[model samples]
Target chain A: MLKAIQNLGSSTTTTTRTTTGFVASFYRLKPPHATTTSAFVSISSSLLSYYSPRTRPTKPLLFLTRKTLSLEPVRAHSTRSESKMDDTSSSSSVAVQSSGSVRKINFCQWCGGQTKHDIPDGEEKMRAICTVCGKITYQNPKMVVGCLIEHDNKVLLCKRNIQPSFGLWTLPAGYLEIGESAAEGAIRETWEEAHAEVEVVSPFAHLDIPLIGQTYIIFLAKLRKPHFSPGPESLECQLFSLDDIPFDSLAFSSMAVTLKLYIEDVKAGSRKFHYGTINKRPGTSPSDTHGYTLVNHLQS
Target chain B: MLKAIQNLGSSTTTTTRTTTGFVASFYRLKPPHATTTSAFVSISSSLLSYYSPRTRPTKPLLFLTRKTLSLEPVRAHSTRSESKMDDTSSSSSVAVQSSGSVRKINFCQWCGGQTKHDIPDGEEKMRAICTVCGKITYQNPKMVVGCLIEHDNKVLLCKRNIQPSFGLWTLPAGYLEIGESAAEGAIRETWEEAHAEVEVVSPFAHLDIPLIGQTYIIFLAKLRKPHFSPGPESLECQLFSLDDIPFDSLAFSSMAVTLKLYIEDVKAGSRKFHYGTINKRPGTSPSDTHGYTLVNHLQS
Candidate 1:
C-alpha cells in the first residue's frame, strides 16, 4: 500500500496501503476550501471522521435499533438490476435507497431513478438501490470548484471543449476531486486546461447551486508566468478585461454569476469573500428572512 | 422517470430524465451542494464520457482520415478490466500507450499509487485515480470548519469526541459535508451537536491544511436562543469565557492555533476576517509549509 500523505496545520499522516505495502505521499497541504480570507474559525475533524468509509458499525445493533424505531416509514425494494441503456435523454426509473433516515417512494432523490431496494429490513430504515448504478442513491449535494487566474490586468478564459456548453468561454473550473484540496485541484486544472504556472492567492467566492446539486468555491490566483497554451480540454485560451468579457458566450449560469460578483468587488474596491453563487442569487443578507429568493439584481 | 429540474436563469430548463418515462419535476430546486452558494461544475459528459459499461469497438475503419489519424494515438486503452476483487493492499500500475506518442503511466506523484488517468489524450494532464475506488484522486487540501456559539460573553466548548487528544476541550466543529454549503453545514452541525442556533456574525478564521488533506474555515457566529442539548456527536458541551478556555485540553493542533488567532482577533477588535489558522504558532507552521504528515491518532 503506497501512501501519499500531506499534512495540514501540523505534521500528520494519512496512509492508503496497497497489497505490496507501497506508500505514496504529498506535501505542503493547504486548506481544501477557502474564501478571500484564509482566516476561518477552528473546527476539528473528530466528528468528520465518523463518516469515513472505514467507519464500522460501532454498535451496529444500536444503530439498527434506532433505524427500526425512527418515525420515518420504509418502503419495499421493488426494482431489479436492469441497465438503463437508453440515452440520458430517455426517461427511466430505478429506485435507489439512501443510507440516511429519509426515504421517498416514487423515485430516487439523487439520480431520479426508480426505488429498487426499498425494503423495510428489521431496521426501520428503507434501502433503495438504484437500478442504473446498482448503488444506493441519496440526496447528496455535489462538489463544485474553480479557479480565478489573473494575468496582468486581464483574466484568462477558455472556450470549453466539452458540454453542456461546448464552445462557451469561461475560467478554468470543475468539480472537486475526491481526497483533493479545492486549491490544489484548482491550480492543477489551471495547468491542465490553460497550461499556466500559477500561484493561488486567496479564496474569493463560495456559492451553492441547489438546482444542480453542487457547492462551489472560486479562488483568486495569479499566473507565475504569463506564457500559456490551451490544452485539449479547452477550445481556446485568451485574456479579457471586465468590459470585454464575452457575457453571452460564457458556459453555465454559475460562471456568469461569479464573474459578476468579481466585477462588483473590483468596482467597490472590496476584496472580501462573498457567499452565494449567481445560480442561487442569495438575497441581500445572510441573516435575512426573505426565504431564499431574489428580490432583484443589483444593477451595475 | 422522475426529473428533478431547477429553474434556469435563461430559458434553459433544468430537466432531469430517469430511465423510466415518468418525470417528476420540482419547481424550486434544492441548492446543488447543500450550501446556498455556487453551481455544480462537472466535466463535459459528452466529450469526456468514456469506457461505459457498453463500450465496444465498432466496425474497423476502412480508410484512416486526417482527423482520425490525429486521434489514433489516443485510442490506446488497457485491455484489463477494472480489478474488482484484487487485494486492495497491493500497489498497482496503469500505463496508457498510443501508437507513436510516449507511453504514459497513471500514478500519484506523491504516493505512487496507480490512481492517475490521462486526460483524454492530453500530455502531463492526467488525474490521479484511486485504485481502490477506481476513481481519480487529487492531492488536495483539507477543510476545517467550525462555529462560534456565544452566550452572554462566554462561548461554547466541548471535549474532543474522537482523536489525537480525545479528551481535549475546544469549540464544536468538523468537516464540511459532501453536498453542504459551508455556512449551512457549519450552522447545522452546531445545532446537531451543540443543540444551539447561532447566527454567524462575521467571517472568522481560515487555515490551509494541505498536509492532512484538510482545510479549516471557522466562522464567528453569535448565539441565539441558548437553550439546548448536546447531541450524540459530542462528549460534553459547555460555555467558557476567554479566560476560562482549557488550552491544555484542546483537541487537534489546529484548535490551539485557531484559539490563538481568535483571541488575537478578539483583542485587536478585528472581527472582519483573518487569513491563516495558526500563523501565530511557529512549530505548527512547518506542516503548513510542507503539507500534512499523517499520524496514527486517527485510527480507531
Candidate 2:
C-alpha cells in the first residue's frame, strides 16, 4: 500500500486546482518546487557521507547467496486471490493485473495515439504498442521506502485512516519519490505518516512482495525526539513497547516481517541486513499476515 | 538505460508480432507463460533459505547512520544537462523529462478518458487526471538490478549493442521486472547481457541515480561457469581484469560507482555493502562518469 500512503485529501471535500492553462495553476509542471512537502526533514545520521577516499578494508564476513529465484511457475506464492483493497495506488493499475480483468491500454501516454496489445519487433511479451508513435508502455514494480523507528524503547505505529488497510497498524512507509534515495524516502514517509523526525541507522530489510509488484525497503531508525503526531493519512499514531505491539492487526506482510526481525534482533542484540519475500495467503484481510510464508535470504 | 537494456530488437528489423485477437498469438495476457525467458537459471547459492525458527543472532556491526539525505534545493548533482540518448526505455517517457519539453498526458491510460494536468482535491501537485474516470496517474523511478561478477580473477563486462550506450562497456544489468526480486533480476540480467549464469554472493552496492530516477542494485556474484556469449542486447561479452577495465568508456554513472567500489574492495581485500548517490556531471557522455562526485553513505 506504499505509494507514499497515496491520495491524502478526502474526495468528498474536493476542489480541483488546475495548472497549464486548462486548469488554474496550483503547480508548475517543473518539479523544483514541491507544493505538497509540508514536513521538514531533519535526521541524525549522515545519509550522504561527503566522499574522501580511503583504502582500508576489514576482513570479509559471511555472505548469503541465492542459487535461483524462479518466476516461471504457477507462483504458488499467491496463496489467495488478491483483493483490490490491497492495492490503493492509482499508479498500481499501470502494470500487473487480475486475471479476470486487466487494464487495457487503448491510447499511448506519450503520443495519445490509439494503442493495441502487440509484440513489437524482437520482443516476446505483448506490449501496448502505439500505432502512431510506435512506442511501448513499460511498467515495473514500485519501491516503498520507510523506516522502523525506535524511540524511548518503543516502536511508532500509525492507525491508517486511509482505505487500503483502513484501521490497521503500519510502519511509516510509502512510495520512493523520483529523484530521491531510499533513506530520503524513509525519512519523508516517517514525517508524513507520524509527523515525527527520524535518522536512519541502516537499511534493515529489502523485501519483495512480488505478487503486488512492490519492493519495501525498510530502514532501522531512531526518533529525533519522543514527540509525534498523526498526519492526514492516519487516524491516530501511538508508540508501543514490544508486549503492546499489535501483531495480529499489522498492515502488510512486509511490516510484520520487519517488526518480527526487529524484535528478534532486539532480543539477540544483533542488527543485520535482510533480503527476502513474503508469499501472502488467500482470503485474509489485507492487514492479516497469518499463514504467509517468508523467504529470508540472510538466514539461509 | 537498464530497463532490461531496453528494446532488444532493432526497430528496423523488428517483425511486428501479435497476440490476442488483433495480432499473431505470441503470448497470452496471463503472465505465467514468459514467452521470452530463454535461459535456464542455475545459481550456486540459495537465494531463498526456507524459513526456520532460530534463537541466537550474530553480533551487530558498526551501523552507519544517515541524518538526512535531502531532496530539496537545485539538486546540484546535475552538473550538466542530460542527453535523451541516455535513456532508451520505452517507459522512460512515463515520467521525468527535460525542462524544455515534458510529456503531456492527454488521456487516462486506464480508461482512455481524456486527461489534463490538474491538482486533485487535497493534493498539491498537478497530476494527469482522468476527467471521465476521475483517476490519477503517478510515476516513480525504476529499479535496475544487475551484478558485478568475479570470474577467474576477472570481472564481466558487456559491450552494448543497444542504445543509450552502444559500444560502451558496462556491467550486466537491466530493469527489475515486475514479479521479480532484485537478486533474480540481477541474475536474469547477467544471463541476458552476458549469457552467463551467476550466483549472487551478496548484495554489494545499492546506489541511486536519482537524477534519472533510477536505483541500481548491484550484487557481488560468481559466474556459474567461464563460458558466456553476448545476448541480444550486447555486441560482445568479455571478461576484463581490473587493470584492463575501460574506465573512460564505462556506461552510466551508477555503473562507475559500482565498479569503483568493487575495485576498492578488491584492493582492500574486503567485501562490504555500499549505498550512495552519483552526481553525474552535465554535458558529459552518459558513459563518461568523470568529474562526477560520489557521496557514499557507508564510507561516510
Candidate 3:
C-alpha cells in the first residue's frame, strides 16, 4: 500500500493518496469536510516518514475535499475501472480550493465529459467547455468570515490546533456554509474555534486577498458574557489586550490585520468600516512576520 | 433530437437540453458564464413551445453551466457512452447555481469514483463519501457583490435586460469571481450593466439569504464622472432619487432591501454599515412586492 502510495505518478495523485489515507486514518484529526492544510502537512509528514526514497513535494493546499465527491458513482466506478485512473489522479487537481478553484476545469462532473478550453460564441475569455453536454463550470472567490470578539477591552483569539500554521494564535474563522448567513457563519466559526457566543457589533473589515482568491469578512463583536473554552479546532482560546496580543504569532494575515484595526479603532475613538486589500509581505512565507501589508481604499 | 430534448429523463436533463439549445441557439442571449434565469425563461418558453404534447415544467434556474463542465473527456465520454448518461442527466442537477451548488456530492470529480452519503466517523451530518477514493466534496455559499453608486442624492439603477425580472430595475451586480475583490467585482458589474465607472466609498451592506445560499456584499460608491449608458445586461441606466425610486419594479429582494436601506440612511443622516438577511416574501415569487423582508441584527 505504501509502495503504491510512493509510486503515485503525479503530485496530484500523491496528494490524493495522502489525503485519502489521512481521511481514512482518523476522523478525529478534524472532519474531512473542514480539513485544513495543517492537517495535510501533519499527515503528509507521517506519510513521508514512512518512505524516505521519494519525498513527494507537498502542496500548500488541502483542496482534495473541495474538488472531489460525486453524485453519480456507478458511472464514476465504471469509468475508474476503465481508463480514468490516470486522468482522475491528474486533471482534478487544478482549481480546487476553499478559496474557490479557478482555471482549467477539465472534467464535467455532470457527464464525465472531457472539456475543451474554448471561448463559447460570445465570451471574451476561454472556458472549460464540456464536449458532451457543453457545460461550463465556474470557480469563484470564497468568503472567510470570522469574529474579533471583545470582552473587557480584550480580543478573543484561538490557538490553532491543526496545520499550515499549527500552534499559532488566530481569529475564529472558516468558510461560510450553506443555510447560514455571513453573520451566522461568523458566529458558528467563533463557537467552533473558541466555544464563545458573540454579539456582532458591526462590520469591521472587508479585506481582500486576490492572490489566494478569498475575502475575509471580520466582524467586530462583543462576548455575550465571559464564558468560553476551546472547541476542536483550537488548542487554547485566550483574551488578549493590544499590549499583549501575539502580533508575531497569528496564524493568518487577516487575523493580524483585524486585531490591529480593532486597536486602531479603539485608540482613534472613531469607529468606521474598514475595507482594503492584503498583499503578501516581501521575502517571507505568508506566515512569516505579520505576513501582509494592508492597503486601505479611501473611506466614504 | 426534438424527442431526445423532450424525453430528457430528468428536469435536470430537460434543463440541460434547454440550456444547450439556448447556448447553441445564440450566444447573444448572454455569455453562459453569467447567464440568469431570465435567459432560461426566454429560451424555455421557445423550447416548451416546440413540444406541446409534453409540457415538461421549466425550472426557475440557470444552473447547468456551473455544474456541467468536465476536464477528463476520455473518461467522461467513455462513462457517458455507457450507463453514465442517465445518471449524469439526473445526478448533476442538484446543488448548483450562481448562488453556489449545495448538497449531494456523489461522484468523485477526481477519480470518477462512486460515493456514499455517510457521516464519516466524527461529522455532525452526513457528507458524500467516495467509496473509491474516500474523498469528500463540500459546497459553500456564493457572493453577489455590487455597487450602490450615489451622486447628487440619486442612486444609479440599471433596468435589467435579462430574466426572472426583465425590464425591472436593479443595482449592477453579479457573482464574485476568482481574481478580484468584492469591491472590484462590484465595480466590474457596474461597468457591465450600466456602462459607468465609479469609485468605491465603503463597504455598505453584507446581506445574507440563507435560503438561496448567497451573500450580497454591496459597496457605497460615487460615479467617477457624469458619463453613463446602458450595457448589454441593462435596457436603460438611470439615476433615481428616493422619490422616483421604482420600488415595485425592482428585480430582486436584495436590490430592494439595499435601496430601501439607502433611503432610510439618507433620512437618518447616518450611513452606518448594514448587516442583515433578506428572507423571501410570504406570497411572492421572490420578484413581487420588493420580494423580501430585511431583518437586521442590532447594529454594533
Model number with the top TM-score: 2
Candidate 3 residues A207-294, lDDT tens each?
7765455678877777765888988768999988879999778776677667766776689886666676664432234355343455
TM-score list, all predictions: 0.51, 0.68, 0.67
Q: Which sections of candidate 2 miss by over 4 Å? A: A1-103, B1-103
lDDT of 2 at B275: 61
> Can you write out model 1's per-residue Cα lDDT over A1-300, one digit (the tens) per residue?
011111111112122322211111111112322211112221112112113222233212110100000111222221211111100111111111111212333332223345463432221123445455343322233345667776676888988775445677768876544323465556656666788766556666655542223456667777766687887678889999889988767765556666766886689876556554222211111111111221112110
Residue-level error in angstroms, candidate 3, position B80: 24
Question: Per-residue lDDT of B1-300 in model 3, one digit per residue for the tens?
Answer: 011122101113122333111110111233223333542322212111112221122111212221112111111222111110001111133224322232334355556576675545533434445678675554556778888988898999988675546677888888776545676667766776777767666667777765556788888877766888998768999999889999878877778778777787789886766676654432344356343445433232
lDDT of 2 at A299: 26
Fnat, one value per model: 0.04, 0.34, 0.35
Write the candidate numbers in order of decreasing DockQ: 3, 2, 1
Residue A35 shift from truth in candidate 3, angstroms: 31
State candidate 2's TM-score.
0.68
Model 2 agreement with the true structure over A1-300: per-residue lDDT tens digits: 011111111112112221210100011111213222212211111100110012012111112221111111122221111222234222334333321012256777666788776545654434566788775665667788888888788989998877566788989888775545677667767777788866666667777765556788877777766778898778899989988899878777678778887787789876666666554443334466564555434321
DockQ for every prediction shown: 0.04, 0.14, 0.16
* Model 1 stretches with alpha carbons more than 4 Å out: A1-143, A178-180, A277-300, B1-144, B161-165, B206-208, B274-300
